[model samples]
Target: MFNTIEHINKENRNWLKSFYFIHKLSFRTLWARKASWVGTFIFSCCLLILFPFGLGTEALQRADIQIGTFWIMNEFVAVLTISRIFSAEQECNGMDLILTSKLQKTSIIAGKISFTAFQIFTLQIPILLLWIIFYNINSNILVNLLNNLFFVSIFFNLGSASLGTLITCLTARSLAKEILLPMLFFPLQSGILLASVSLTIHIGNNSLLGAFSESAWWTILIAYPIIFSTLGILLSDLLLQE
Candidate 1:
């Protein structure tokens, strides 16, 4: 019993260390390619700007249109960013190195998902601000819905990032990853995407309490991240095996 407990503790420590190593590597890669990330940020902003022209300025006044535009732009920028999770590693066979190392596969997946989720969350900040500015969000509405939006965005990022990272890993070796990714990702994303959009619309129209009153949307928002994260963890060993 003591030996088993010791083994478990040692494994936990190793997992923690591996998770930290991957996160640090991800940060360094992000820093090294700062220009690319900046360009993605700029491109997302441009996409946000362009939406108004196509939808007409008046469309922004409608909550569904406003939320829809934000989510659509979000999906696009997120796909662009998430697609790069393994690009840097693959270029120099870094993933190959990691996969063969002593590090735990589950920890590696966790680290990647955490970083990707954080990165996407960070990127969403400016777009969300611009969204508010571009649409001239009413201060009262913003204040009333601020907490709800914050939680909704967190759930949104977590679900999408977990699923996106997993899908990216699954397609990492494919010759047609770019084409395959969006085809697989976007369709799978429809549930969380629709849930988030609906939650946003509800919160915007009905506040957090009111949104929670709609049990179905609330359930999807909560279940999405949990489901995808569990799937990613459970499959990491199989996915990363040689």
Candidate 2:
């Protein structure tokens, strides 16, 4: 019994080390490519700027319309980020090094998904602030709305990022991966997007408790990450074998 417990604890510690190693690798690689993140930040700002002109400023101020537009912009960002999963490694055969090491494949996929999700969430923060500035939200509701938006953004990004990581890995070796990535990604992600939008609209109008009370929306928001993250971890070894 004592040996079994020690073995399990050792395994847990190793898994965490592997997870952090992969995450750190991704961070350094992405940070080296400043153009990618800089371009994405510019793209996000441009979207926010042009959207009002297309929708007309008056319509853009309407809560539902603006919220929906913001989410759609995030969807685009998710596609761009997720499409690049495993890309850095592919360029340098870094993935081969990782596979050849004793690092856990499950930890590897989790780390990649987490990094992508965290990047998306961080990028969205400025966009969210810009959104508040652009729409000139009522000062009274500003804090409350921001709180709700933050909550939704966390799960929304996680769910999309989780599934996107899996699909991106699966198609990483394909000749037309760029084309295939978005095609496979958007359809899978649409349900989560809708749930996020709906929750945003609800919480914008009501309170956080009110949004959670709507069980269907809440279920999707909660379940999406759990379901897809599991699939990603389970299939990662098989997918990465290629």
Candidate 3:
């Protein structure tokens, strides 16, 4: 019994160390390549600026339009960039290095998801600020706007992040991954995308915190992240194996 307990504790310690190592590595990898995503963010800003033309300046001046535009840009950017999370590893054969090492597969997946989710959030920040400026969002709406943005990013990102990992691992070695990723990812994303959009629309109508609690948004927000993140986490080992 003592030996079993000792073995379990050692395994836990090694797992925790591997987790932190991979997490730190994810940050380092993205930071070194930060310009790639930052450029994407700038591109999004330009796209949002042009949006007033098609959406109509007056129509986009509405609070709902502003909020919707922010998340819609996020959804678009995520779809475009999600493949890169693992593509880097595959491109350089980093996966083989990892595979031969003692690192846990789930830890690597968690790190990728963490980095992707955080990247998605970073991508939204500039667009969201531009959103507020363009819409002339009042001080009264600021708190609720930020609140919903924060939570919705979390919920929306959970699903996207997981989907990002699942697709990356599944397609890491594929010759057609660039073409295949969006096809695979967007379908998994549609339900969460639709849910978050509905939730955003409800929030746009303004009932503050009460609006979230009163509608199906809360359930949809809570359920999707849990379901998708779990699926990604549980299947990661199988997905990453040689």
Candidate 4:
């Protein structure tokens, strides 16, 4: 039991060190171009605001459109936000420094993921607040909406981050990243949007317990991120080699 406890402690220490190193790298990357990051945040906020107007009053009344618009906005932002992670590093010539550092590749990747997740979370804040302010949703509905947003954010962000990392690893240069990232991301984004939107609409129109009772759709939304994140980590070294 003592030996097991010591081994667990050592593993925990290693994990914490990895997380700290990655967090620093992630913050530095975001800080390096505060202006661009701010711009992206504002742009995403505007896009989210446009949803109500863009969907029109008729669509807003329709549970399907309302839910669909929310997910579409979320998926769009997530995919775009993550697709740029590594490409940005390469553009600034920071990849070379990162590659040569003593940090483990896993830590570097974790840092990138952490940084991307922060950006995504920051971007979501304005949208969520705006959504709650503008919509006539009730407190219970709002809570449900917020819950859906949280889950969708986690699912889409993790999947996109992993996919972005893989793409960055494969391309090694910025131009290819610009061209290829969207192509690879959009289909997955569409699928996620479809599942989330459909589920949200169903939940919004039905009882909470009833919605939760529904199977398969929720499972898919929750499962995609896990599968993709694992795939991304597993493939990172192989893709990064070139």
Candidate 5:
């Protein structure tokens, strides 16, 4: 079903070829499940519209809810998309073929992370816009918010991909896959969410006081991607044990 690599150089050459193959497959598979992501997108938008009605329009209330809701929605989107990432391979019976292919596990992890971030970024774009529109946030802060989201998404997606990959691989053969993903994911993710939400609120309030200005939060933003992605790359090979 596959060609043998006759030379070391040829093997190296084909690794990237395999990576791109998986990369494109990952992106295409994400969009193929558009209904799932679309439902989350529409649901988030509705929640944004209804938040003010449910929580009152006071500035303090809006500020608190804006950052909290946006971050949760982003995290939720990551879970919704990423939880299914590995399951897609298992569901199609391609897990064995993929793990045994010419591609290195790190290459597979890189390809998967690239596409996962891409999907999350695309989904968050409209949600961000809706957040600004519905919350009456300052228009001038739009660029700032996007900049923050850019960094936060990188950190969040890295952690999400790591946890998602780990959990999915471990739970792929489990009878209660859905129940296990979130149970394991949210606990590992709480720190990232806390830091992201605080930083976002600081950006909105036009102040960098307290937790937002703390170096610890910045470290988390910088370290999360590096740590989680590195871990994912390292631990990704463990999937073969299953």
Candidate 6:
């Protein structure tokens, strides 16, 4: 149970505490279901491998190919990763238990989002290693790659987590919630996928673009997550009203 939020408590403090508690609980719950998490992780790895093929070797080798093949791979994995977060909970009736807890609604939602983000981060490691090996990138380029990957992961996670939270909240009671959840995330995933691919290509060609740079494309990546995370938090209150 969370420390009670008195009426006079500052909103920022309350939300911050709630976010922390929620993330903690979510991680614990997710750890309890290790098999499913591992399975999803492996599946993401396989999908990442298959994605480079879609871009073709020629494109992969092209230095100027905006949003190179690896970006495509990460984007694909992002979709699958985000969709699984809430849908898996729905299947196990975990959302109901979470909602019934004394924790703030925002906390519950943030916790789930955090867990999904961590899972996605874990899934990206092998893909990153593969890219490092295949691209024969120098040490400086490798550092840049890591920076880009970090931000891209954050961007995709925010959007995907927002979409997942929205779906889970809206369809918590529906028999078809599991299926419906993934559908809600598809469009968001597609956008992130495109952005990721474009960013990947840009970074591969130009080593100077930091992940959080002021460039228009970087702005898009940064903005999408901020917008979605805010929307998700706002929508969560209404969605959990029942």
Predicted candidate 5 versus true structure: per-residue lDDT over 144-242, tens digit per residue: 877877887777777677667666777777899889888988887777777777777777775543544556887876676678777777887786453
Give Cα distance to truth, residue 154, candidate 6, Å.
2.0
Alpha-carbon deviation at 230 in model 4, angstroms: 1.8
The sequence of per-residue lDDT tens digits that candidate 1 reaches over residues 1-242 is 99999999999999999999998888877758796478788988888889889989887787767777888888877787788888877776777889989999899889988888888888888888988888887676687556777887788888888889889878877899899999999989887787777777775665332333467776887797889888889999887875
What is candidate 2's lDDT per residue for 1-242, written digit by digit as tens? 99999999999999999999998888878868865577788898899899988889888767777777888789878877776677877787888899899998899989988999998987888888898788777676677767877877889889988998888887877899888888898888877887788877775565332333567877888788999999989887787784
Model 4 lDDT per residue over 2-106, tens place: 999999998777767866976776567666777546776677677767876877766776555655666666665676677667656667776777677655566
Better of 1 and 5 by TM-score: 1
Candidate 1: the clashing residue pairs are none
Give Cα distance to truth, residue 30, candidate 5, Å.
3.0
Q: What is the lDDT of candidate 3?
A: 0.74
Task: Give candidate 6 misplaced runs (Cα > 4 Å).
Answer: 1-7, 10-17, 48-59, 63-67, 91-93, 134-140, 206-214
lDDT of 4 at 147: 72
Say which prediction, candidate 2 or candidate 3, comes out ahead on lDDT: 2
Each candidate structure's TM-score, on Cα atoms with residue i matched to residue i, is 0.92, 0.93, 0.88, 0.80, 0.84, 0.74
Clashing pairs in 5: none
Clashing pairs in 4: none
**Better by TM-score, candidate 3 or 1:** 1
TM-score of 5: 0.84
Instruction: Compose the digit string of candidate 6's lDDT tens values, residues 93-132.
Output: 7667766766577766676777777776776777678666
- Each candidate's number of clashing pairs is 0, 0, 0, 0, 0, 3
Candidate 3: Cα lDDT at 141 = 70
Report the number of backbone clashes for model 2. Answer: 0
Considering summed lDDT, which 10 consecutive residues are worst modelled in model 6? 205-214
